[model samples]
Target: MSDLVIGLGGLAMMFALMVFRMPVGMAMLAAGYFGTVLISGARSANALLVTETFSAASNYSLTVIPLFILMGNIASVAGFSSRLYEAAFAWVGFLRGGLASASIIGCAAFAAVSGSSVATAVTIGKVALPEMKRFRYSDALATGAIAAGGTLGFLIPPSTGFVLYAILTEESIGQLFMAGILPGLLLTALFMAAVALVTLKDPEAGPRGEWVSISMRMRALMRALPLVTVIIVSIGGIYLGVFTPVEAAGIGAGLVILMAIGMRKLDWRMLQQAVSDTVGTTAMLYLIVIGASVLNPFLALTHVPAMLGEAMTSAGLGPYGVLLLIIIAYLVLGMFMDGLAMLVVTIPIFFPIITGLGFDPIWFGVVAVIVIEMGMITPPVGLNVFVVKSVAQDVPMATIFRGVIPFWVAMAVCLLAVIVFPQIALTIPSAMFR
Candidate 1:
């Protein structure tokens, strides 16, 4: 078969496996192994598997993934996420839709320490859902807010996504982490604003509550001092060259664990659970990734992406038009796929074309992350939606999905801002480096 036909066939097979509920990693691994054997014969495919798996697993970059994952797990056991939410709530829980708004802020804070969207969603859902429910917050609003807020986990600093993106794109993790701050805040603000506005327009979604005293707010902030210190020290360390991203993850993880122990929130069982959970979660992510490594070579062998890139350029779409198309594609894909799986399947093809188009790598990285953030809250297979749905089981799955709509809108706007201004995403990296 022609390479395009072969490529298309392989892609179809992979998706079919996904539809069959095969793990993404297993599906990709199977498709890649078979596709390679079909196109290039057994011996060549055998060598490809050994070498690709080795290279993929052996890289220094991939080490960052498990470390970040481990750190999040440790922090989760430390009960740091609860404190973060309570801190945000004490300040924002008084306004219209403020409970929901507080959830978003809490998610952002948790993301600084917890890099996984699912972890952030589940953790925040546990802490904020009960409080929001007690206040008679709409099921849709409460559940949706947590799902949407959960996405901030992957976009904020110490994000595994950002770290992986830097590794794949060869951008500086420190700078990419730094570049993320403004855009991260921009996305969070957009989410909160959407929550407030939607609740304002539909008062039933959020009931009004009394504002708290300044003393209370200040005390609440003090309660989350460990998180604040971790953020400052880890981010400050990375940006200031005092530590690499990996080293910073260690520091953050250790500090959060120590604080949790100090607070007496963590028991021996919780600590064990943390380690076990981290290992399981990390294993799942790695499986899909290893599968991608095998599949990626096959995808390249087919040359479909390169051919498509050429065709896009030839169609008079220009670089920007193609970029627009890519963004739209990501938005659509985000609805159906896990963010990392989507990234693994797509970035190899997109990265070359993006760099070839002369777009700034740092800027595109931020934009891609925002797009992925959109995916985390999207339906069918959105991790964040599932996270919230699992925690708030009484709230129907559909309601949780619907609730994410406004935040998705906010995400869309944030995405556009990144696209149009570019500077909002790039200025920090550019300034710091130059």
Candidate 2:
């Protein structure tokens, strides 16, 4: 078969492997290995594999991945997530769907400090799910809120996915990080709006809890100051060019350790767990990076992405048409593949097309981050939902899925807004650079 045909064939076989329940990283490796061999035979494939494995595993640019992840894990161990929830809940819990809203806010705060959707979902689920349930929130609303809220991890400043994308595309990490800020806030607001609307309509969906006095709110806020400081320093330091992204991760991680020690949250075991968890997650990401390096050069040999770019450019599809096509494809794929796997696989091919279409690389990065965020809450492969389900075993999976429906709808609107208003994605980065 020709290279194009072989590449297409590999994609088909990848879908087949996924449908058969193979793990994602293994599936990608198997398909990538076989695909390269099919296109250029075993001798070439072997050479390609050895080179990619070394380049991927040994990459200095990639070191930032593990450090950022380590920073996030250390922050989690320090127990800032619960503190965020408590503060947000105290201020908002009296409103209808307040706890659910707090769950969204809490998750957003966690996203600021952590990079993993699963961690955000699991952490917030443990803290807020029961309170939402005790207040007689419907299982759908409660579980769905937490599940959908967790997607913020992908678009927020500290996001692992964003950092990975920045590395892959050779964009300025600080610019991309700043670019995401506005869209992230907009998406978070939309989620809160969704929860409030649901509560307002049913009133029964979210019971109004006792209102906190100003003193109580002040106490709650004080508890969250350290978390606020961490976020401000880490993100602000990078965006303002005071430090590199890697340096910011180091500073944040060290400060988190200090704070955790002061808060009495970290001990020997917790610290060990943080390091171990960071290592494991980092290893998994590098493995995918390895697979991508192997797979991408082989894909590059195929010229399919370039060919598609030529066709689209020649056909006069314009930017809007291409944008629509990308979004539609992501929505469809989210139902079948893990969001990160989908991102890693498709982005290599699509990034070129997107950049060639006259969009700013930083702007496109923000847009892709939003799409990936939606994918995190999307089903079958909705990793966040699975995380919440694992934590709230008593809540039926179906209920969690059902509750996320409106939030998903809200996300759709938010996506449309970003697509229509490029400024929403570009403004922060531009302002920062200016």
- Top-lDDT structure, candidate number: 1
Candidate lDDT scores, in order, read 0.84, 0.83
Query: Candidates' TM-scores?
Result: 0.96, 0.95
Give candidate 1's error at residue 255 in angstroms.
1.5
Write out the backbone clash pairs for model 1.
none
Which stretches of model 2 miss by more than 4 angstroms?
314-316
The number of clashing residue pairs in model 2 is 0
> 1-434 in candidate 1: lDDT tens per residue?
78778888999999899888899899999899999999999999899888877876787766666776766777777777777887888888888888898888998988887777888888888989999899999999999889988888788887778776775566788888888989999989898899878887899889865688999889889988877898889888887779888788888778878887888988999889988888888788777667888888898899988987887778888889989989999989988888987887888789888899999888888889889988888877778888787888888888888888888899999988999899998887777778
> Measured by TM-score, how close is model 1 to the native structure?
0.96
TM-score of 2: 0.95
Off by over 4 Å in 1: none
| Model 1 per-residue lDDT at 246 | 79
